[model samples]
Target: MSNSEITTHDPTSISRKSKKKKWSKPKKIWVSVLVVFLLFLGGAGTYAGFLYSKFDQTLNKISGSNGKTANAAFIPVATEPITILLMGIDARGDGETLNSDVIMPFTLNPITKSATLVSVPRDMEITFDGHSRKSNYVFPHYYIVDKEHAFPKTKEFWSNKLGIPIDYMVTVDFQGFREAIDVLGGIDVNVKMDMCYQDSTDGTNINLKAGQQHLDGAATLDYVRYRKSNCGTKESTDYDRNLRQQEVLDQLFSKLKSFDMVTKVTDILNVVGDNLETDISPDNLKQLILSYMNIDRGKINFIGLNGEWVSPFMVIPDEEWENAKRALKIERMRTAANPNPTIDPKTRLGTDMKSNYRSSGNNASSDSNSSKSQSSNKNTDASSKSKEKSSTGSGSKATPTPRSTNNLKSNSKSNSNQGSSGVEADDRVPKVD
Candidate 1:
C-alpha cells in the first residue's frame, strides 16, 4: 500500500495492495502448517526407532532365558587354552540330582581347533576329594557338595590327571539326551550284531538285530546300554555298543541341521537351557554356534572309548584310556584346522577293526583255506591241528594272550585274522596303536 504513497492515493493501487495482503497471509499460514506437520513426522520417526530398540532388547533377553546364558560373564585367561568336559549322566529318577555314567573330558586346542573325548569309566577307583566314596558316585555328590563347584572340581582332577587345562563342563542328563534324540525325530545306526538280552530284574527286554536300524529314544538307549542286558554269543561287546553311540550322535547332529529341524531345535534349546550345565561363556557359545552352523554333515568325527569291562575292578584301565585320549586329541587338532579333511579309510568304519582281528582265534599258520577246512570238518581237523600245534580249540586256536598289543596288531597273522580280515561292518573309525 505504501508504493510512493500509493501513487498519490490512487483507488486501483489500494485494491491491488489489499489483494496482495490477502494472498501473503494465506501463504504464511500454509508455510507454518507445513513446518508443524514436518516436525510431527520427525518426532514420530525418532519414537519409532526408540521403540524398535526396546523391542530388540526384549527379544534378546527372552532368547537368553537360561540362567547360564544370562548369567555367564567371562574374563579371558590370556593365552591359556580352552577345554571342555562332556559328561553323559545316567539318572533313573525324576530328581534334579544326577550321577554321570560316562565322564569324558574333551580338551579343545583353540589354536588347532581340534577336540578330544577322554572317557572316564563310572567305576574308576580315582580319589573323590570331597566325597568319601568311589569315583563313580561323585556326580550325585555335586548336587549336595556345592552343586555348582563339584563338576568344575571334577574337571580339574581329570585335567591334572591328563595334563590339560579344562575350561568348561557340559553335562547332559539321560532324560535330556533322550529328549534331544526324540527332537531329531530319530537316528540311524548300524547295529553290528544281534542284541538279545533278557533281564527279569530290570524289566528290560531288548532284541535288536544286526544291520542298520532307525532308533527312537528307548531303543537308542538300549543300543548304547546293551552291555547291561543280554546280547548274543556273537562276541558283540560294550565296545560295539559304544560304536553305536557314536553313530547315533552323528545322525542326531545331521538331523539337527536339516530344514525341518528349526522348530524342533528351538524346542531343544528350551530343553537344553533347562537341563544342560556348561561353563561355556555365552560369547563362546554363540561363536561356536555360528562357526558350526554352516559346517558340512561329515565334518565332525564321533568316537568311542576303547577299553575293557573289568568285572572284578568294575572299571576300565587308563592305559587304553590314554591311547583313546591321544587319538581324540589328534583328531580334534586335524578337524579344527580343516573341518573337511579326508578321513582315513579305517576311521570311516564305525567299529574297531583291530578288535575284530585280534579277537579272532586264527593263527599265522591258519590260512583262509585251513579256516574253511577246519569249519567244515571240525572234529577231524581239530585233532590234526592239535597234534600239529600244542594249543587246541576246535576251529578256534589258542595262543598266549599278549598283555597288551599297545594297539599294534598281534604279530601272529593267524591270531589276528579273525572276523572279516580287519574290515568293519560300517567303516567310520580307524584302528589305533
Candidate 2:
C-alpha cells in the first residue's frame, strides 16, 4: 500500500498530507467553487424525477460515519426536538492544527416551527481537565490525539462542561465556509460598526464598512472573524464577533432557501464531499431538511451564556448554570438529556440564548426586571449539587424577555408555540425586527 493510504485514522495524517501536498491557486479556486455548490445542499430540496437520481449518486461519494474515533449512535427522528452543533473550523498556518472558528448549536423545534442557536464563543473559557484554552481549541486538540475519536470526545467535553446534551456535530472548515458563501453568491447582512484590521501572518485582512452590505466568501470570513474594531462607537469583543457570525449564517440560510439553490446541488455535493464531516449520513441530512424546513426565521432565538471572568477560565455562576440547564432541557431525563448523564463534579455558573432562566424554585411570571427580585441570585446555591445527577428543573417556567450578554436576563415563553410540557422548553421567541 502507498504511504498515503497507510493511516486512515491518525490525526497526524492531516499534517503529513499538508506538508506533502499544496494546491495551486486555480486548484484552490476550484475547491472553493465546488464547496460553495456543496453548501446549497444544507438547505432543503424536493427530489423527484431525474433530480433525485442525480443527487443520490453524487451524495454516495460523500462519506459518513461517527465522525469520531469512538462509536456513537445516529440520532433518529424525534418529535421532541434535536440539537446540531454547527462547527466552523479554520486551518492553522502550519496546517497541522485546526481551530473551531465558529461554534453554534442549531436546535430545531418541531412544534413551534422555529430553530434556536445557542452559540458558544470560541473564547469562552472552560476547564478541559488539566488544560484550559478557548473552547474552540478543544476540537483540534482532540482531533490530533485521535482523528476518528476526536469528534465524540469534543462533543463530550462541551456536554459535560455546559450541562447540555448535543445530538450531532457538523464540522466544516474555513475554506469550505468561504467557498460555500462565494458559491451562494455571497450573503447580505447589517454590520453594526466599521471594522479594520490586518494580520499578514495568518493572511487575515478585515476592512469592512459599517452598516448593511454584501460580503463574498473572503469578506464573510472577514466579517465574522473580526473581533477587534477601529470604530470607537462599536463594542469589539469575542461576544460581538460571535453575534455577527450567527447573523451572517442566519442571513445565508435565508438566502439559500430560494429555488436558485437547486442548480448548485451537484457542485455542492462534491465540494462538501471532502470538506464537511458529520456522524449524520446524507439520508440524515435529507431527513433534517424535511423535518425542520418550515422553521420561522422570525422566531429564531439566540442565547449566550453569561460568565464571571475568572483569571484564566471564565467561571460559570451557580444561578446561571441552573438557568442554562433549564433552558437547554438537560435537567430531566427529557428526550434531549445526555444518554448517560453524570453530574459535573466541578462547581460552576450558567444561562442561555434566549436569555431564558428557569429557577429550581419559582414558576412565577415577571414582565420586567423590576418585578423580579434584585437581591442577586436568590435560589442560586453554588454549594448544592444539581437537582439530580442530571440538571433537570421542570418547575422553572419560561418567560420571554430581552436577551442579556451580562446576567442573561428574562426567560421567554410563548403560549402560541407550546413546547413539550415534558420535553421542549419555552419558544416565545422575540421578533427579529
Candidate 3:
C-alpha cells in the first residue's frame, strides 16, 4: 500500500482527538455555568445596593432629617440597654389634634437578649399642667400647644411619670399601622369575644366575631380599638385592648422575621417611610436590627398596667406602678459578666403579674372574664370603703375622686362646636364607655 493512501492509524493522534471531543462539551457547559453565576452575583449586588439606598432614604425621612446625621445622644451601641417610647397616635383627619391611643415603654437589653414592654393605659389619669387628665391627652395637648417641642416634651412627661430614662421615641399613626399590617398580608389573632361598636363621628365601625382568625389591617385595628359594643355584645376594657396589642405585635414581628418578608421589603419600607417616625439615628437603627435580629420571642416580656376604673379615668394602683418601675429597672441591668448571658427567671419581676391580665391556651377568655369579675369585686369593695371613709372622715389614704358626669357633659357640648385643637376642657377627652 502507498504510504500517503494508507490510513495513518496513529494511536496517539486518535487518543488526542478523542480526548478533545470528550472535554469540549463539558468545558463549554462549565464556562456557561460560570458566566451565569457571575451574572447572578452582579444582579444580586445591584439589587442589594438598591435596597440599601432605599433603606437609607427611608430612615432619613423617619428620623426627620434630610441628611445622614443623627442625634448623638440617641445612638445605641453594642449590647447596651435602651428604652424606646412607642406611641400609637390616632389622628382621625387632617388638621385634627393627635392623641396617643397606645403608650408603650419598651426596654431592650442586648447583653441578656431580653426585652420588657409595659403598656400604659390610655385612660390612666396623669397630672399635666397642674390639672389631672387622661394619659393619652398629654401628647395631644403638647402637640397642640407647642408643635416644635411636642416630641421632646412628651418624652419628658413620660420619663418623669414612669421614672425611666427614655432614649428615643417612635410614633405611628392609625393609618400607618393599618397599612403596615396590610403590607404583611395581615396577622393571625384570636379575638377574645364578639366585638361590635359603631361611631358615626370618626367613622369607626368595629364588628369582629370571637375565635382564631386571620385579620386584615382595618379589622386588626378594630380588634384593638373595640372599647364598647353598642349592639349589646360584650365590652372590652383598656387592659383587654393592651393584651390584644401585645398579641398582635408578637404575630407581626414573627411575620417580619420570616423568609416571605424578603420579597416584601420595598413595600414594607414604603409603608414605614410614609407612616412611621422615629428618633433613632439610621446607623443605630441598623445596629439594633443586626444585634437583636435573632432574639427569642419567649425572652420578650409584656406587662400590662391594671387599675380601677373611676368613671372616665383609670386610676392605676401605687403598688402596680412600683412593680412596673422595678421590672423595667431590673431589665435594664446587665444579667451576667460574660458576653453571652442567660436571663434569670427570678429577676423578671412583672412577668408573673402579666398572667393576671393575659392568659394562654383554650380557656383564655374564661380566665380573662374571671379576672374581670375579680377586678369588679375589688372595685366594689374599694367603693364601699371609700364611702365609709368619707362618711366617717377617718381614713389615712385618700381615694381618687371620680370626674363628675355633669361636668364632662357640659365640657363636651362646649367643645363640640370648636376646632380640633380647641380641647380646652376635659369634656373633649375621649371617654371610656
- Against the reference, the lDDT scores of all candidates come to 0.42, 0.50, 0.57
Where is model 3 poorest over a 10-residue stretch in terms of lDDT?
10-19
**Prediction 3 global C-alpha lDDT:** 0.57
Q: Give the CA lDDT, 0 to 100, for residue 418 in model 3.
A: 30
| 290 Cα displacement, candidate 2 (Å) | 3.0
Task: Compose the digit string of candidate 1's lDDT tens values, residues 17-105.
Answer: 11112222212222222222212222322332333344334334433442123223353422223456677755443343254555666
Q: What is the Cα-based TM-score of model 2?
A: 0.62
Kindly report which residue stretches of model 2 are placed more than 4 angstroms away from their true locations once superposed.
1-72, 78-80, 110-112, 229-235, 306-324, 330-433
Best by lDDT: 3
- What TM-score would each prediction reach against the true structure? 0.54, 0.62, 0.65
Q: Give the C-alpha miss distance for residue 359 in model 2, angstroms.
A: 30
How much RMSD separates candidate 2 from the native structure?
A: 14.5
Question: Which has the greatest TM-score?
Answer: 3
Candidate 3 lDDT over 298-353, as tens digits, reads 78889998876654566676566767867776777655675233445344322121
Report, for all candidates in order, the number of backbone clashes.
22, 21, 0
**Pick by lDDT: 1 or 3, better one:** 3
lDDT of 3 at 287: 57
Candidate 3: segments with Cα more than 4 A from true spot: 1-72, 338-433
